[model samples]
Target: MAAYTGPGRDTLSDVLDWAVVRGGAPSVAVQVQDGDGTWFDAAGTADAATGEARAPGERLHLGGISQAYTAATVLSLEAEGRLSLDDTVERWLPGALAGNGYDGSRVTVRHLLSHTSGLFSTGMALEVQRRYGTRAAFREHRYDVWRREDVLRLAVSEPPAGAPGERFWYSTGGYAFAAAIVEAATGNSFESEVDRAVVRPLGLTHTFVRHRADPGYWGPHPRLHSKMFFRDGVRPEDVTPDNWPSLLEDPALPPLDTTKANTSWAWGAANVVAPLDELIVFMDALITGDLLPEAQHRAMWATESTKGAHWLAHTAYGLGVYELTLSDGRTLRGCTGASTGAHALVLGTPDGRRTLAAHVANDYSGFPVFDRLLEAEFGAPGFAYDR
Candidate 1:
């Protein structure tokens, strides 16, 4: 009920200053915009061995922010009359997703965009990798696939969960199904569609489709560590590296790069990678109507978010964007991404009315530093800050 009335929320001036004072080495690159204007800061190290503090203009892989980009592209296609939000997935991918497990005919594009399709998570799909025993099998089977539908044939197995338009369940598999529809309707790879529809329109230079095994594009990503020890109130590494760590301890992560396929990325689900700056620019533009027509813009942002007790502050998802209400009563529309050791997030107030901050770190976020730094900048209630 109380707003953050912190002493100096106006200037997270103490944020980086404290790090410098404590001799704490926090290498971070942030592009922020208060109501006034934009500012860029890169004070973190890109690589310890290289002593590369994040440079002023370097490209880092933006994880799930790609979802927003996906939405923009889909809406752009709608403008071109190439697709319809009301259309059903069955219309696009006939034999692939018709009246069997789901009322694919009734499941419109809107459902997927709003995350209301009640689709199950994509963890089942990842299980298919087990079929390929040798590492070389993973390379040939996982990486070489171009069509998402083909992967769906092998990977996707989520029978419809809720009704056609019932409750909400966060699932990238649904988005990937949407991507399959886009491809079926347009006859082009989802990568090509996004490149033309969103990236080119916004002039996002550093963004690209991570459709293939391009380590150069992925850049440097740390191994992922998680909260295996949930009850310890301690980091998971303390409970001894979890199963994943044990699996990937030796050569570390088993080089998922052997194959060109980023199946984990799925279709329109996650196969996007961009620099942090480009992500902010894209979000700012999308919110300000630099991307969509007025009506389409309203449709995308105004979609209903039927979230429950989990994330009470705010829980809304559009074609690819999520609107999160921070503790300060300002809604920050953004997304979070995690893959192995790579993690990222981009959050900011609409139109840069007050503030914007993005974090991209190579390790898992349960380390507690993330939420701490986030609160330090975007304070919680009773902080007596400018908000």
Candidate 2:
């Protein structure tokens, strides 16, 4: 890894340039806001075949960052007195988690939001990986549709990971349950709830929650490419038009087209899509207490230690966001998302004065690139770039 430094050079541009050089992805899009001002930049080709440069406002799959919206909606429902965070899942949808030795009564809305519900993630099931996890399988069934109930059932059918709240376990299935609770309590679709609670209120015109049945809903966006590993080695593959599901199982497959895959399988957990700029706005609002009442907002940041979670290092899992403690003793509150060929990250101070939101048109392996960018952006004095 090389560090970029020179007279009159921009830090954001240099960081993105270094990411590309380090093979973070074939293309990257980023937005940053500080006391100085705001900036947006893109690098590499979005469509490898056509050699099109990545655009600034191109929409990309939000991945697990969608959890933030889902969590916020749940909190909003709690604020309205429609539900309580401590309410059991069975209280909202009876018998939804009765089988597979699972007890919804033992799980609460808070547990689901915090990923402490002990639910086994259907997204991590072996069968799911074989059927829709690889690039080849993704191409075979890019348009496969799934219902919320069916997906939830598949998740619960798996064995429980542990007792509810025993320890921290990141589970997409928990968020699925949380979304179902939202629908049941509000008597409206989860998508509709998100629109009313977050999108319309924020004037976010480009953000949307995609459903599995909507196959023809390809709006204007950049071509998504995957930095997939093949027998030959890692290479960039244009996965636009649909194939995100491929990376769900085995992310090491050869980069294949995932831009057109049905994302319903990731519904409620990782199905939202938005441009990088809107993502920053959303994060700012979220961290600034604009989305929830004062107490609820405070509760949202009450984080649980993820020391042994084997997921994120030196981090804490909040209601739906993550609080990452940098090596420099500074902390950032935001979320990061990855789905197949798309990866995104947004982090800022509690006051919302400084923020950074970035997206890479690649898969899981791009995370290290994001780590380096964060170090460059917020590293403390005497920090060394050890790569």
Candidate 3:
């Protein structure tokens, strides 16, 4: 609902147009807040099939950015004395993480939230999927469902990369374990807890945790596409209608249409959706301490080394959030996320004076436009990156 006005609107529009022209992202939705004014804009198509143009306020998957909400929910429960960051995974899930050289007894909730758990990632399973899970394979088993245990089992089927808290290693499986902790401690489903702690409290009516039976998007949501298989002698695919069961099946195939995929595989890791406007609001609230208590908020930004774990430079991992030190001295606090065909980046100044939340209907590689857009809005000095 925010409107871009004034002289800068033209610059912003130009940057967005350039994104579609050069970044290869078919669609992009962005919202920015500066002091008291907010701006929202969208460029390119929402659905290739319908030739629908992207619209402001349309929802898109938050991808790994959903980790921020999960972290906030856990921290809220901690504030309620229902859980503690130091609590070990074994304390809640018992022997849930016992095999493949993984020891849950030594992995604390903080470790999981901070990506220091060193547990095997679902990416370990993905190596197999990429080889055999092609588009045709996905069509055959698209609707298959996976339970939480199934996800945990797949993650641990391979040996852990490191010991708990020894170093930073991004792992969606760790967050899935954290979600299980939320359930065990709160006596509520992960979806309900996130709703109670983050979504409802923030009045984010457009956001929801997705499930197998749930349609991926609500009204007017953008259809997601990807260039995942371009390197494999295949063209870009519209992965907006099929389930992601191929993630667990054999003869791994190319990235299938994940738009309607059952997100149970992602669960606590990356299954949240909201429009750019709502995400901007969420980032503003998060950085300004509206989401968690002072201690937890501080903890969320207390980052550790993520060297070699992330693609971006000057990046560090915090509790479910990423601390990115811009070329300027200012630090942007929020997270970046990617699903099959959706990529999101939400960041805000510590004082909440400026916020930027942008989503592109493409994969992780389709993010240069966002960087350029950030530089356009925040000045070139704030977003100097290696390309």
Which candidate number maximizes lDDT? 2
Candidate 1 wrongly placed segments (more than 4 Å)? 1-27, 42-44, 98-100, 124-147, 213-215, 218-265, 309-313, 366-370, 380-387
Best-to-worst TM-score order: 3, 2, 1
Alpha-carbon shift of residue 102 in model 2 (angstroms): 0.4
Candidate 3, residues 139-210, lDDT tens digits: the string is 445455668788777667778878988988777888889888999998888999999999988999898887
Give candidate 3 regions above 4 Å deviation. Answer: 6-8, 126-133, 230-258, 380-387
TM-score for each model: 0.74, 0.88, 0.88
Instruction: State the lDDT of candidate 2 residue by residue for 248-299, as single tens digits.
Output: 3344445665666677776778888888778888889889999799978987
Worst 10 residues of 3 by lDDT: 234-243
lDDT of 3 at 99: 79
Q: 258, model 1: CA deviation in Å?
A: 12
Taken over the whole model, the C-alpha lDDT of each candidate is 0.57, 0.76, 0.75
Q: What is the lDDT of candidate 3?
A: 0.75
Which residue runs of candidate 2 sit more than 4 Å off their true CA positions?
1-9, 215-218, 227-254, 380-387
For all candidates, what are the clash counts?
A: 13, 10, 13
Of 1 and 2, which scores higher on lDDT? Answer: 2
Clashing pairs in 2: 239-257, 239-258, 241-259, 241-260, 242-258, 242-259, 242-260, 242-261, 243-258, 243-261
